[model samples]
Target: MSQITRIKGSHRAASLVIAGSAVTTSGLVATAEDAVDIRAQTRSVLSQAEALFSRAGLRKSDITRVQIWLADMADFPAMNEIYDAWVDPEHAPVRACVGAALANKHYLIEIQVYGYQPD
Candidate 1:
């Protein structure tokens, strides 16, 4: 078994972690100007996720699954507008999105990603 390694730049415990060929991240949320705006927030979250994937030497296409949490279900359409554009149709990850209260009231959406690389 391989020792787990950590990815910096996220909150404690929920930061990105990698062991062997797989990469896992704590739920990603928006910050600064992005948090309150549904579109910006969704974009910020994906950008954060992309940065994590890059840190793991992977790409958005590498992600196999994702779970999205939305603070308001009414924001779903707006969030999807950004998400549908960000993900590649051919390699789109299996995904789930649900409305829920988030850790931060300002956060409109949160995302967690799972990705893999073949040895």
Candidate 2:
């Protein structure tokens, strides 16, 4: 069996977990400064996800799935605009976006990423 590795952050939960060839990240939120703008919040969240992927030795292309949560449905289009530009069209991962209340009112968006590490 492959050992599970966890990368922890200052928060109570692990930031990223790696088991076998799979890598998963905890929900990533936008910075306080970007929280007011959907586009900026989306960009901030994705950038944080990218940083986590890099730590796991994975890239955006390696992502297999993505889960996104928006504080308001009205922000969907704005979020997609940034997401569309950041994701590789040829390697786009399966994704789901939905409107829901975030942990913090200031967080306009949150993103979770899942990917596979190549052998």
Candidate 3:
């Protein structure tokens, strides 16, 4: 079995997983200590995901798949607005966004990313 490595964020969860050159993370929510509105929370989640990518020696362009969970479908536009700004449109990966209950009510968005590093 490939050893799984966890890339921990400033938050308590050690969610990011690494095996071989592949990297994947669990749903990451807003990093703001205080409760934030949907727009702000969405941005925060993306920022945190970016940080994780950096830690894993991966770039947004390396992402192969992206999964997003929103507390409300209405937040789609808001989440994509920030996400579109963060990801490279020319090399965009497969993605899915759906409305679902999150770990925290304060969280408006959560994202998981998977990427592979060239050997």
Candidate 4:
């Protein structure tokens, strides 16, 4: 059986979880002061995901899937602008985006990703 490793979060949720080669991150939102803007929020979320990926021994190219949640669909293009710049175009992951009411009113976007941490 593969060992499971959890990192950085409260009892309610783990920021990152790794089970064998499969790595997953909890839904991540922007924590920056400019987080109210979709562009800034997306950048912050992706940065957070990147940090967790590094901790799990993964890279942008190792990402297999991406899930994004937006407070408003209108922000999609703005979020994509940042996302497109950050993602590994050579190994772009399967992705899905949808509009949802976020936990925080100030949050404009949230992102979660699944990746492979090869042995």
Candidate 5:
């Protein structure tokens, strides 16, 4: 049987963990309740991803792949700039970036990662 785990945060949705893989659902923007910037939002998502991996007892080098969805294609370059520095250059994971209208218009990007936690 596959074990499932979830983590809820203010800006991001529940991150689901099945076996060794972590799947982050789309994180929607907060309306009147909270205020955050575009770059901050992107950083939050990355932070959430990192936390998920940590909770699973894995390291950044364990990540095998990642999928990034952006509300606007124009944000791709900016997102990539941060992502490149965020990951280890020697063991970067395979990734795909796509343009899509996210849950809320305020949200600029959402990233989901797949990692391996060796037994």
Candidate 6:
């Protein structure tokens, strides 16, 4: 049977949680210091996602879905460049990218992932 574990300080609507060996959700937010570039923001988010998954005992190949929110659509391609290099090609996750004003104006992107771990 699958178990669900929720991480504290995450969004109630889109929080980080682990669901047994079948699924896990990444953290809902990303923050950064002022004067950072979009690429740096992307890297930070990816790093956080990796750490979150690692802590959950999950791997990149386990990812099944991803939703990315961008402050500007123009950044999608750049974000994809980084994202593509981040995940395992053989196990690419289904993804959606859209432009939306983020929590803080300085943040260029925020990503949420849904993944499955082995039994």
Local accuracy of candidate 3 as per-residue lDDT tens digits, 81-105 = 8778877888899999988998877
lDDT of 1 by residue, 7-90 (tens): 775445747888878888898888877765899998899998998888778888899999999988999899899999999999
Clashes of each: 0, 0, 0, 0, 0, 0
The worst-scoring run of ten residues by lDDT in candidate 5 lies at 26-35
Superposed by TM-score, candidate 1 places the C-alpha of residue 46 at a distance from the truth, in angstroms, of: 0.3
Return whichever of 2 and 5 wins on lDDT: 2
lDDT of 4 by residue, 31-70 (tens): 8586768888888999999999988768888899999999
Cα error of candidate 5 at position 23, Å: 7.0
> Tell me, what's the RMSD of every candidate?
1.4, 1.0, 2.3, 1.0, 3.8, 2.5
| Span of 10 residues, lowest total lDDT, candidate 3 | 30-39
Those runs of model 2 whose alpha carbons end farther than 4 Å from true positions after fitting are none
User: Would you give me the overall lDDT of model 3?
Assistant: 0.80
lDDT of 2 by residue, 1-119 (tens): 89899999666889899999999999999877776699998888899999988988888999999999989999888889899999999999999998898888888888999999999
> Which prediction has more favorable TM-score, 1 or 4?
4
User: How high is each candidate's TM-score?
Assistant: 0.92, 0.95, 0.86, 0.95, 0.75, 0.82
- Return the lDDT, model 3, position 38: 75
For model 5, the superposed segments whose C-alpha errors exceed 4 Å read: 1-14, 20-37
Worst 10 residues of 2 by lDDT: 30-39
Q: Rank the candidates by lDDT, best first.
A: 2, 4, 1, 3, 6, 5
Worst 10 residues of 1 by lDDT: 7-16
**Per-model lDDT:** 0.87, 0.90, 0.80, 0.90, 0.68, 0.75
Where model 3 places Cα greater than 4 Å from the true spot, the runs are: 1-3, 9-13
- Candidate 2 clashing pairs? none
